[model samples]
Target: MSPTSDLLAAALAQSGFHPRLPQQRRLYEAAKAAIHQQRLGAGGKLPSSRDLARDLGMARNTVIAAFEQLAAEGYVVSSRGSGTYVADLQAHSASMRGVGATPQGRSTAPAATPSARLSRRGQELTSYAAGPQFEIQPFAPGDPDFSSFPFKLWQRLQNRVWREARNDLLDYGQSGGHLPLRQAITEYLRISRSVKVEVEQVMITAGTQQSLDLCAQLLADVGDTAWIEDPCYWGARRVFQARELKLRPITVDSDGIAIAAADLATKPRLIYVTPSHQYPTGAVMSLARRRELLDVAVRKDAWILEDDYDSEFRYTGRPLAALQGLDHDDRVLYMGTFSKVLYPGIKVGYLVVPPALIPAFRSALYDLQRPGQLTVQATLADFITLGHFTAHVRKIRQTYGARRELLRHMLAQKLPRSVTISREESGLHLVIELPDQVDDMALAQQAAMQGISVKALSTYYLKPPIRRGLLVGYAYCTPEQITDYGRLLGTIIAAEAAA
Candidate 1:
């Protein structure tokens, strides 16, 4: 038989339309008809493993196995050095057609009912949306210039870890993460952030998002109120909302989240704050406000979630001590992530819970979550203990600080008279307040068209529209890119203002 015929026969047998195996014979017969009817034809390569896998909702290996089986049956022929090909089975086509025949002509099958498609609850969440084409610029908040990351050093460490890893390293690691990593984190946080916690108090998580989710579950019940900053992190709001916890927006000024009469009125179960540098509005919580917040948490019997994100990149004098350091009442639940200092893809973060909560927190994490790769964690711990992590952060801090200055200078020179930049002291991002008349959403969309991605501050608010502004990040952008991004953003703002 020719290769085409041989392939056709093999495909038929592989599909299982044989005289035996009655359970799947109907499907096999149907598939055979589709092939004969030119629905699947000669000279056409079989569907890719992925496509077949999807169609059958089976693993790719299964489809590949079936194809191999067909080749073995001599219905399909495998070329000595080429891919499998259909056998020209013209001789048996007529006979095979009769096997599945009905009096009407060919047996017809019932159509499959469509299954419901799953979707995420709200509108598709993205940092930027499609819009006008602006100049290619870097405006994404909190994205460090990935190009500056020590790829060579990281690869060397990764290679070393992989070479040294035992067979056990391939298995599921401790849910609390690799022990050495936890110890390294404990030591580092104690020395750097002044956090008083042992390795037992720390729980490794898949970065800040997972840490926040775990915290929300552990600390608050459904319907419990969680106070977030007015111009807070949108991601945290999403996390809170997903857990069905009520999010109350507390107003923020130069001193961070204002925890006064209004915050007390909400009777929040947990208060989430980015004390080191507030999100969107880059205000650091003053010493007085931090003290007051700790006191309120104690008085109200509420837990304070200190999201000490981006504290490592403080450009000014020494970074402020974490609120966790000052909390004598054990009210602070500290969260930190390597995403800001390193790459987000690392997915390593630590949550420092009060001593009382450690046991329960570890148990919850153990029961509900699986640990990340053991080798990665162990290697990272070695990196930190060896001082590479500190050195990398120090180098990047200077690079980002210079980039921030360039951005600030460009903004001052190019931004419209009506727009004002706020809180440039310490963080990867700065906020630019726009006029009330300009719609931030429209401006963001317009800027996106110019190939620039800028965020609108109004989107972060839960209640009480606070400030209309753009949260521009310069960390990932180079000095040149920062200048260009600022200019593009200024142009967009100016055009919008003129309009």
Candidate 2:
């Protein structure tokens, strides 16, 4: 059959629409739409896998796999000499008219099914609207400007680690992490964040997400209350929810997590806070609130998990001390990630527990956590100890600071008076609060149509009637891209407000 015939046949078969996988279903729907729209006409040759992949902005393998599946189902025909062809779909259309129904005249698929498997706790999650075009922007949250990383210095340190590393580095070094890296982290946290902990108190995790998971496992029993911030980080909330913990959201103010007059009726066993720079909202926890929270934790005998992600990128004024620094009763468990400072793919983050809890935490981690690659940890330790890590942080701090300023300036120029931009002092993201009339989720979806990615703050909330705001990230985008993105976002927001 000709290429057009094969394409038509595949489209016709897919129109019957019993896709086992959601991704496969999406591909089938897209293919059917293309055929029905006459994009793939009878006798017309279908595009090559490479061409289709390029056009669709998908992996070549994905396109090839889709085509192969279609061919296997007798929807398309492929030959050795001629390219793949659309099958004569008209021959099958009549027979497929009733294929949507089962033999007993009922729908084959259920109306509702279980959701996809949950990702690990605290994993960096991209918004639903984030696509290739969204990624093309300069500074989206959770991304570091990899181009700014000092690869040459990193390579040299890696070489040295390889030269000096012992055979034991090849094996599983430790459940906590490589000893040297743990030692380095212990020292670094003590000096930098005022987190008092010994090398034994530090446990290396896959990132902040794993740290959250480890904490959840160690402290929270199912159905226990875990207090999270209102409009908090979605990943953390999901982690708590996955463990079947009841999530209690506390409202946040300018100084950060507002625990005053909070409904403690649930009597939460754990409190998760991003004190350095609050996630999404970017509000720094004030010294008073930090002290108040520590007091509350002590009173309630609750464990506090302080996620210090992106604390190293403070652009304006001095960096605030970590919440763990203010803990007097050893109730705070501090978590830090190199994912933001070094790179995301490194999958290296450290958790500092109280001295008394170290043994139990370590024991639990060893039992449940998969130890990271020893060689990488050893190399990373050498990088930090040799001062390359500090130097890289210094360089990127300046770069991110410049980009933050540029983004803020652009927003001020483009955005209306009603739109409020929050806390551009530190971290990769700023929260844009729109007028109450505008729906942030709808605005984000609309922006996606224009190839601009923006996150709605409402999705992070667990309670009903969510807030309306956008989380704008600037870690990956360049200055120019930020300007363009700002203008585009301003236009979208303005249009939405008017509508």
- Model 2 lDDT per residue over 83-118, tens place: 665544543432345333222333221111111122
Report the Cα lDDT for candidate 2. Answer: 0.75
Worst 10 residues of 1 by lDDT: 109-118
**Candidate 1 residues 434-472, lDDT tens each?**
888889988888888877788888887877566788888
Model 1 residue 30 lDDT score: 40
Off by over 4 Å in 2: 1-139, 260-262, 465-467
RMSD of each: 12.1, 9.7
* Cα-based lDDT at residue 234, candidate 2: 73
